[model samples]
Target chain A: MLAIVVLLVIWWVAYWLKLQPPHLLPSPLDVWGTFTKLLTNGAVWEAVTKSLQRAFLGFAISVVLGTLLGLALAQFTLFRRAFGPLITGLQILPSIAWVPAAILWFSISTEAMLFVVILGATPSIANGLASGIAQMPSIYPRVGKMLGATGFDAIRFVILPAALPGYIAGLRQGWAFAWRSLMAAELIAYAPALGIGLGQVLQQGRELVDMPMVMTAIILILFVGILVELCIFAPLERYVLKQRGLAGAKR
Target chain B: MSESTIVPDSSPRAVAERSGLHVPESLIDAATAVSINRVSKSFGNDLNPDGSLRAPVLKEISLDVRQGEFVCLLGASGCGKSTLLNLIAGLDSPTQGTIETPGGRTALMFQESALFPWLTAGDNIKLALRLADVPKAEWNDEIERLLELVHLGGQGSKRIHELSGGMRQRVALARALAQRSKILLMDEPFAALDAITRDVLHEELSRIWQEQDLTIIFVTHNVREAVRLGQRVMLMSSRPGTFVRQWDVDVTGERRIEAPEIAALASEITTDLRREIRRHAK
Candidate 1:
């Protein structure tokens, strides 16, 4: 509610200041009108579904490989010594930076877009899992062993649950990376057969000087990211925290 | 709080009578639950340039705990009492000696409850039961029985955070029991509780120890707590900890922390413990 009020205030302030023409910086009312128009057109829905498909597929691949890599890095000293620094270095490399290499490797294809998303997301997920395992309380393992949870059983029952918070944090970061990388790929790849995605829609709006269409695409992109975070990850994280008695309602 | 027999009869006559036709295979298995001989432990970084070993935490510590004996290891803070207990618990190995526990498995209880916060009270015990190899079919009944043993029969479903400190420790005790081990090692399990709660748990521990026929090696810095619970108290010296003294408190019935005999024994031990500390000052 407060966020909506803040957005309204920013919009009114920009209009009052006369900072830019309506064609470049569309008014809040104009953006809203565009939103309604796109909602009825069916084209916006197609782009949204396609963007979501790409993001989900790339994020899924990143999670599997990243979790495996993170576990190995955390558990084995040799593996950590060899690749830990390099993995952390990868996290700071921008998702946009991968577009050029991905285009060269896969040649303006969906596979190229996927390559960029996975590359962008995997390090953050892996780092999250590794740090989570590293931060586990020593007492957890002691109690686990005393109770006869050994090796794989210990990892499954004790280590994994203990590391859930960190892993979830990693997942959140990975999703952000995948989303950004997907948009960057779609904007740059220019594959005619890839169909309409939000990134492509925004790029086409730029080419045609359709400011309302660009603004609509931007709003949808932001809305989708925030929606998934609130609807999926937030609830999942809250449930885990609540189960551990770590989450409490404010007094 | 039914006033059942909280003390076991260790009398020769009782032993002779029990050694008759009713001798079970478990009874004939081992006379001692834990045997530690000349045990010493040291910790230091091996990569240190000087290559000199750090002073041993515990040294030349030899002790034997008979089956069903409640023994307390009493010492000052740095006496390595905890190190000795860990060695006996098999959490760590002794640097210079051997620890033998012929008694199948041992369960250890820490000062903190250490219950998994994610689990309900009942689920905590169930995890222990699972690890102890209790069959899945028997878990419900076994969980109920163990909760009842800790006097927490119907409170199993409560989350760990909802329980009071005393109740949490009781749940910890129940989890330990679910291990179904021959020996229970308690590392000052009640040291953190308030006086009233500690007194109550002392009684609870005494009753449970007798009923379960468990051999317990309890480590503590509190003299009264040691005297209140143990059949025998062994004092350890600090700095390369070694057994300095042992006292057998010959109380036959349930013992209280405030009992005259307990206070007297505690004072004597305290005097010896202070002297050991003074020796370290020089």
Candidate 2:
């Protein structure tokens, strides 16, 4: 709430000071009006649902592949030695790098967008999970062994649960990357077959020189990101922390 | 809590004696719970710049613990007493010779309690029971009985974080009991607790030991703690830890940590422990 107010104040001050012309950077009130206009017209909902569907699909696939990759990296010395550095390198590489190659491979369709999203998100999730497992308290696995949880059972009930906070961290970072990658993909691949997304709308706004629409699109993107974080990842992170009594809530 | 009410049914162990981490075609005679035969454990592969081998943590240690024995293996810090207990628990293997717990998979307790923070005290015990292959239907009642055994009755619903250090250890004790193992290994389980809590746990442990008929090999650096709990105390030398001395406390009734007998025995053990430390100082 404080962040929203501060951001609004910053935008209002900037508008009052004429940081940029009205066509370039419009007033917060102007952007708000554009936002309401878009909302009432219902075009924003189509873009939102389209982008969200693609994001979720890409993220879900990334989660599976990333987790498997992460576990293999954490578990096998050969896998870690072979691919660990490569995964770290991929994490540093931006989503933009993948767009041209993805577009060439899949021709500006859902496949291209998904390919970019997966490439962008998977490395961070895998790395986060791998690192978390690596730093897991040594005592937990030993305790599990003593209690007769061997092999897969140990991984499922003991090791994975112990490494949960790390896995959750991976999921959180992975989602952010997925969202950013999706937007980048949408912005670049403005093909008719790609339909419309928030990023495509923002690109259209820029082409038409509509600053209010651009601001509105930007805020919508930010709003979706914040909403997902609060609605999904926040509860998950909170649940894990609460399990360990680290959530700081009064017992 | 009355001691008489905490009597455990022997039927559980009798019925499940065959269920363990690994089934054996033959077990060592029932008289001995554990037999460590010339066991030596050394960290492998790692070497000094001089290309010399590191001294084994446990150097040719041999011992036999009878059924229902509460044996304390006492030593100073870095004496590898925990390494020995770890060997007995079958978490690690001896580099040379053999350590066998024929009775089955041994339950272990550590100074930190080792309770999963994600689980409530009861659920922790349930996890142990489930892993031990105890029937699912019996979990709730067994959890109640085990918590009651540790004098933490009705506290099973509490989260591990909700419990104090001493209470957490009690919950750990209850969880250990849930494993239904014939042997229990403790490595400085109470070393992290306050003196008063430690003393109280000692008494509780003694009562539970007799009631459960468990063979416990408790390792600790504290001389007074060793004398306070164990029926037979074995003192290990420093560094490459090997048992050097043993004494049996002949007292039958309640033993106080500060009693004259306890103090006398503690001082004598401290002397042996100090002599081992002095060798390092030299």
Candidate 3:
């Protein structure tokens, strides 16, 4: 609620100052009008659904792949020695870098969007989990062994729980990457089959020179990011941190 | 709290008897729960420039911990009391000599509670039970029982941060006991607590130790704490840690920190420890 009010105040100030042309910066009222029209037409909801589906799918794939890879890297010396440098290098590369290859490989489909999202997100998740596993206190594994917690039980009960805070942090980073990658993919490859996403709407507004529509699309994208963080990732992160007593009761 | 209630069906006697049956001749021959035979530990593979082997942290340390005995390894900061405890717990290996512990497991409690922060107090105990392969049917009841043992019967659901410093250590004790191990290794577990809480814990520890009959090897730099807790106090010299002196404490019933014997023994150990530290300075 406070964010909305602040955004409105910024919009009013920008309009009063005549900052840029009307085609470049639309008034808050103009963006609201476009929002209402888009809402009534159901286009905003459709775009939101499509974007959410892609983001969630990409996130799921990243989590599974990242966790397994993280565990492998943490547990095996050979794997760590072989892939450690490559993994670090991969983290530095932006998701935008994969756009060309993703377009060629998956050809402007949902698969292409997912490919970029995974490429962007997996390294963060894997690194988070790997570092967390490494940081576990030395006493934990020894206690597990003394109690006969070998094989799967040791990994499941002891190792995983010990590393969970780090893993959750990684997942949060991965989600951000996935969200960004989805927007990038949608902008680059706008097609009917790919459906309408925020990026596609922004692109359409750009072509028609509809500044209010473009501002609406950009606002919607920002809104969606903040909403997801509050509704999904923030709560999840809070719960994990609270469980470990890392986050105080301020939330 | 009920005065006559037993914590769990898995009594300490039963655990002792079970381990007694499995005791190897090597361990039983020494009539001790742990027998360290000329054990020496050193870090790295390098020899000194003078063509002599590097000094060991523990040098040919031979010691025996009799069954159900409370032994304190008293020394200065670098005297390697903790190193010896680690070797005894099988977390590290001795460079030379042999340690014979009756095939039974040893539970160690660190200076920090070291409880799994993700788990609640009850769940932490449950994890120990789960790792020990206690039957699923018995876990819930056993957790409650263990909580009662530590005077935390209703605090099973409390998170680590919710508990006070002293309370967390008690829960840690309950978790360690949940393993049902024959030997318990404690490395300055109470050093971090306030003096009043430390006094309370000292009483709690003695009561629990007496009731449980656990073979404990406690490591501490505090001479008074050693005199107060251990049946026998073994003093180690610094630089290359070697046994400097040993004192058998004779305190009947519940011992007090203010008791003359306790003070006298502490002073004796302190004098010996001081001399050892002074020798290293030279």
| Index of the highest-DockQ prediction | 2
Model 3 C-alpha lDDT per residue in residues B1-282, reported as the tens digit of each score: 111111111122332353333433443343468877787788875567974448778877777777787889988898888889889888789887888887367888888778888889999899898878799999999999888988888899999988999999999899889998868999999999999999999888988998998888999999889999997787788767778666667677758989887888788778877877888889
Error of 1 at B150 (Å): 0.6
For residue A1, model 1's alpha carbon misses the true position, in angstroms, by 4.5
TM-score of 2: 0.88
Which residue pairs show collisions in model 3?
none
Query: In candidate 1, what are the lDDT values of residues B1-282, reduced to their tens digit?
Result: 111111223222343364332433454354877877777788863322574336778867777677988889998998899888888878888887788997768998887768887789999999999988899999999999988988899999999989999999999999999999979999889888899998888898898998998999999999888998897788888887888666667687858766788888889888887888898989
Candidate 2, A217: how far from true, in Å? 1.6
Whole-model lDDT per candidate: 0.85, 0.84, 0.83
- The candidate 1 chain B region of ten consecutive residues with least summed lDDT is B1-10
Docking class of 3: medium
Q: Name the regions of candidate 2 deviating beyond 4 angstroms.
A: A1-27, A207-209, B1-30, B45-54, B258-260
Task: Say which prediction, candidate 2 or candidate 3, comes out ahead on DockQ.
Answer: 2
- Alpha carbon lDDT of residue A134, candidate 3? 95
Compute the DockQ of candidate 3.
Answer: 0.58
Q: What's the candidate order when arranged by decreasing TM-score?
A: 1, 2, 3
Supply candidate 3's per-residue lDDT for A245.
84
What DockQ values do the models have? 0.68, 0.71, 0.58
By DockQ rank, best first, the candidates go 2, 1, 3
Looking at candidate 2 chain A, the ten consecutive residues that score lowest on lDDT are A242-251
